[model samples]
Target chain A: MAIKVHGIALSTCTGRVLLCLLEKGLEYEIVPLDLANSAHKKQPYLSLNPFGQIPAFEDGDVQIFESRAITKYLSRKYKDTGIDLLGSSSLTETTIVDTWMEVESHQYNVPMQKIIRQMIVNPAYGIASDEKIIEEELEKLGKVLDVYEERLSKCKYLAGDFYSLADLHHVPYLVYFMRTLKSSVITSRPHVNAWWKDISSRPASVKLAESMRI
Target chain B: MAIKVHGIALSTCTGRVLLCLLEKGLEYEIVPLDLANSAHKKQPYLSLNPFGQIPAFEDGDVQIFESRAITKYLSRKYKDTGIDLLGSSSLTETTIVDTWMEVESHQYNVPMQKIIRQMIVNPAYGIASDEKIIEEELEKLGKVLDVYEERLSKCKYLAGDFYSLADLHHVPYLVYFMRTLKSSVITSRPHVNAWWKDISSRPASVKLAESMRI
Candidate 1:
């Protein structure tokens, strides 16, 4: 049986797992959930992912959730097949990759989400954007980006010269983040701009991203 | 030169790395910071951890931040020496461990922190507890715990019969959450209560938690 991912393609977490599948050159199906009716948050889906989240994964007898976990699992399981994203069998390199991955989730993703919600989602729902929130989160994100700019100046990628899961992990949310008007948050930092361009423009990333609706 | 952890022992993130060091039987010194004056958020320390977080780690030429990443690096680097907090020598087992570790961070940690802040931190600071936030977070935590209860009933630990980092990741935060009045949020579920008792009573966890100064 082919691998299966049970979530919509357009969702960020789902897209993360899907992109990993594409990079690994694996065949899989997106078992679409009826989000309009909260189907993903309901019984059968909850049984698959008790947290009631998107992108529950299954491969024959194996099951996993959490987009990062699924991506990590796919990378490890198909280590021989895919482009290596876990740092080429070096613990030191993998540690660096793991460290930046944490930074992406904890530091970078937080302010990115807050800014996007304020600058994009709120406007779509006819809710006024909270200027204070946008300002504070943007400041927070800038500090993280400053760190990224410095790091990327030192290395070709967040983990080092090699592209790893750490870089791919940023793609899903960043695709949304870059769409917002404040994308200059990225463009203003030269090394960061180059790194983003490099990763987002990857054949696998670009191919998967094209299917992701704006 | 012993490993040095740069942060106060009592801090959550700091305690996280310290507990991992103890579990790994690694010698480490705590280089205390004056967090009351925001010393961690300032220069020199920011050089160690650009995000200005606690529990930055140093070992000879190696430096790492983020408690989970630090813990992971320690586990991998010392794979032969310590009680393996990662699952032992099995890719499938490691993936399951990784999955639950993500769950602890994303689903479990969020509600646990919110409940702790509203119930414990708020009250201690002369800020009245927000009952509404507490109620909602507790409900969220209860659902996650229900999943834990079901999972734990089937296996001795989250990643399976053997202990893993996924179980350990809950220690520092749950220590705080357990101190809150809403600790019944954990104790109310039988298997979860047993699981907590088992992990929390481990000598390394108990010894480090004692100096936590709650």
Candidate 2:
């Protein structure tokens, strides 16, 4: 049976899994959840993900949720066919990859999520955007990007010279980030600007970007 | 050089690395940090982890931070001697393990962190505990545990029959959590209680718990 993902392209995390599928050159279908209607937060979908999050996956009998986890599964399951995003064969390289990936989720994604809620979600849902939150998060994000700039100056990718999941993981939110608060956060740093350009331009990311409406 | 962790036993995250090292039966040393003085957030250590988090790790040439990332590295690097916490040999099993670990971090750990701050961190610093925040987080945490209760009912551990890193990662925060909140959250659900008992009593967990002085 073909691989399947229950997610919408517009969702950055859903987009996260989709980008991995595209990068792996794998065929899959998206069973998009109706997030606006709170359908994803209700039953059936909740069975797929108790947390009522999107981008659940299925391959025959195996089912899993969590976008990052789904991508990890795909990277491992299709290790040979795909680009070897995890670098599973190299312990040291995988160590660095895991570190940067953690950095993305823990440090980068945290502030980005708050900023996205204010800049994108609030506006779309008719909730007032909190300028205070945007300011606070953007400051934190700028500091995070500073570290990224320094890291990227030393290495082509977050993990190292070779592009890995760490770099790809940064693409989705960034696509949304660059669209709303364009240029300044990214373009300010030469290395970060080049790094963002490099990864965002990847065929998989470009394809994913086209589908991200909001 | 022997495995050296720049952290303290009282720190749940530092304890996280220690649990893994003990599980692997590897000899290691804890290079304590003066978190009280904000030393971790300063120079020297900042060079170790730009994020300025506790529990930076070093094993000869390899130096990394982010406690979970460090644990992941240790699991893979010492896969043979230690218990195979990753389930790397089986793709499907690894998928489940990855799924639950993500659930642990994104879902369980998020609320737990907030609750811990309101209850434990605030008290220690002579700050009043935010009952409002504690109540809100505990409600969220209760729901998360409901999911855990259901999952544990069907399987011995979060990832299935195996006691993988998924369970191990919960130990640190939980050690602090149970100390403050205690019993009610964990013991309310029989499966969760039993599962907690089983994992926490494991020799490594017991040893790790002993060091979790807070």
Candidate 3:
């Protein structure tokens, strides 16, 4: 049997895993879980993912959840699938991959989540938007983006010259981010925008991203 | 030259790298950074760690920061040093290690930071402490702890029975946590407390933790 992926279409986390799979040239069936109905929280799904989150991977007898973990697992298990998602054999390359992952989680993801919660989720869900708090949070993010521009200026990708999982991991977020920001941040940083354009234009990336629009 | 570790004793992140070194039976010099003096954020140190964080590892020509990445780098580089901090041969075990690392970063670290920010840093630094927000945050964390308890009930450690980087990653937070919580959440979870006792009793853990304390 092929692998089964449990995920919600529109989720950034699920999009993360899907993009990796597309990069790896792996074939798998998507097992859609209804995020609207909290299907993931139920027992059957919980057994597959104790955390009760989507984007759970079931590869034959093995099941792995957590987007980064799943991506790493896929990279390790199917080495011949496609590009070296983990990066080159050199230690420096691997550390760069690890560093970029931490950068995403610590610097980008945390602040971006706050911005999303305030600017998107809160207002969309009928909660009053705290403009002051949102502005403060966005400023923090904008500063971080300045660092991103600096880093990208030095290297072609976040991890280094190579387009590794580091770049891949941020694809979905950037897709939504640029759209939400109306390309203001991306347009400001030419290299960053160019990098985004390059990755988003990939055949696999374009396909996976379109499939994620359900 | 063996290696020089620049870190603060009381810092959780520094303790993370220290514990890993002890576990691997590696010899290194500890150069204690003065947090009060902003040593980490100043001049040469800041250049080594752009983020200006503690637990920066320097070995030979290789300089690495970020505790989790440092530990992973050490485990891989010194493959024959001692116990494997990454994972053993088992796929489940390796995935579990990565899984718990995510759990630490995503769930454990987030709420802990919120609580600490409100209860300790904000108050001590003359910043505002929002008790209401802290209370709300704790309830969110309490839910994650419950899930941890359920997992610990079956396994001996966070990443299953073996003491991997997953367990090590959590040590510093738990230490401060024990000191901070009026009502002990770990104690309430019998299995988790048992696991903590097991890890806490290790000689290396005790020594490294004590020596690193400011």
Candidate 4:
């Protein structure tokens, strides 16, 4: 039986899980949800993920949600099949990976998502984009990128020389931002821009980014 | 040599790392940073944690930052010492734990911390609490707890029957909220209240809670 992913491919979180599966060269089926009809907040989908979120995963008897968690699970489960994403080779390596993963969760994703919501989602729904909020988020994001610029200067990737889940996690959001919003925040920084180019150019990331267009 | 933690004892993020160490029965020394003096943003600390965040951990040659990351590192490093916080017994159990940990990161922590910042932190600094923001956060928090209530009714802990790192991560924020703000938000939900009692009553949690008073 193939692994089942309950989500829309165009969703940011769903894109996250899809990228992991792509990187692992794993075959899986996506069980699409009707977000327009509020299908996710209803009974069956709620049973899969109590939080009423997209991108829930099902494999055998195990079920999980939270894109990061699902990706981590897949990375650990399929680690032998593809490039190692978790960096479990050593305690130190794994710690560095985990540290940057936390950084992504706590720092980067919030502002990036906010910018997306304001610039993309709001306008798509006929709602006006709040320029002030976008500016504020961009400013905060710039500070975070300054830190990233420093870190990337020291290492090839956020975790270290190897490309881990930390780098993979940034792809969907960065792609969305680059497509919809001003790219200067990322492109302006030398190391950050170089790092972005390197990560986004990966075959797996390219495939995932292309899929997200639909 | 004991692990050296560079953070203030009373700080929430610092308290999180401390709770994990106490749970693992590890000896550690605190190298306090004067937050009011902006010591964390200065040289030595920035080198340890590029983000200039609280609670950077140092053990031998390994140095890590991000409170959750440090706790995860400690849990993985000391899995055999005390109770296994990661629950790496099976892929299923670990996935469940990781899911709730992400829930803690993405969902629960945000509004909870916002309410805390408004109700407690701002007031202490002579800033008035924004009632509207507090109400908004509490409403968002209420919905999250409804989901928690549903999850807790199914399992004894957030991950499952075992008290994993998922539960430990909630302690510092909940403790701060309960001590400073009203406890009714947690207490009102039957299952959530019971789970809180079970986690907060742990010996390690008790010690950490008491230590946070200073």
Better of 3 and 4 by lDDT: 4
How well is each residue in A95-119 modelled by candidate 3, as lDDT tens digits? 9788788878887788677766666
Which residue window of length 10 is worst by lDDT in model 1 chain B? B116-125
Report how far off residue B43 is in candidate 2 (Å): 3.5
Per-prediction DockQ: 0.77, 0.83, 0.62, 0.87
List pairs with backbone clashes in candidate 3.
B9-B212
The number of the candidate with the highest TM-score is 4
Model no. 2, DockQ: 0.83
Per-model TM-score versus the true fold: 0.94, 0.97, 0.93, 0.98
Model number with the top DockQ: 4
- Cα lDDT of model 2 overall? 0.88
B68-109, model 1: which lDDT tens digit per residue? 999999898898877888885887899899999999887888
User: Compared with the true structure, what per-residue lDDT tens digits does model 4 show for residues A1-214?
Assistant: 7899999887889999999999999999999998999999998999898889898899877788999999999998888988999998999999999999999999999899999999877877899999999999999999999999998899999999999999999999888888864898889999999999999999989998888773
For A1-214, candidate 1 gives per-residue lDDT tens digits of 8899999877788999999998999999889899889997899898889778898999999989899999999988898987999885787898999999899878888788788778766887789999999989999999999999999999999999999999999998788788878899999999999999999999888987788764
Which parts of model 4 have CA positions greater than 4 angstroms off? none
Name the top lDDT candidate. Answer: 4
Rank by TM-score, descending? 4, 2, 1, 3
The collision pairs in model 2 are none
The alpha-carbon deviation from the true structure for residue A165 of candidate 2, after best TM-score superposition, in angstroms, is 0.7
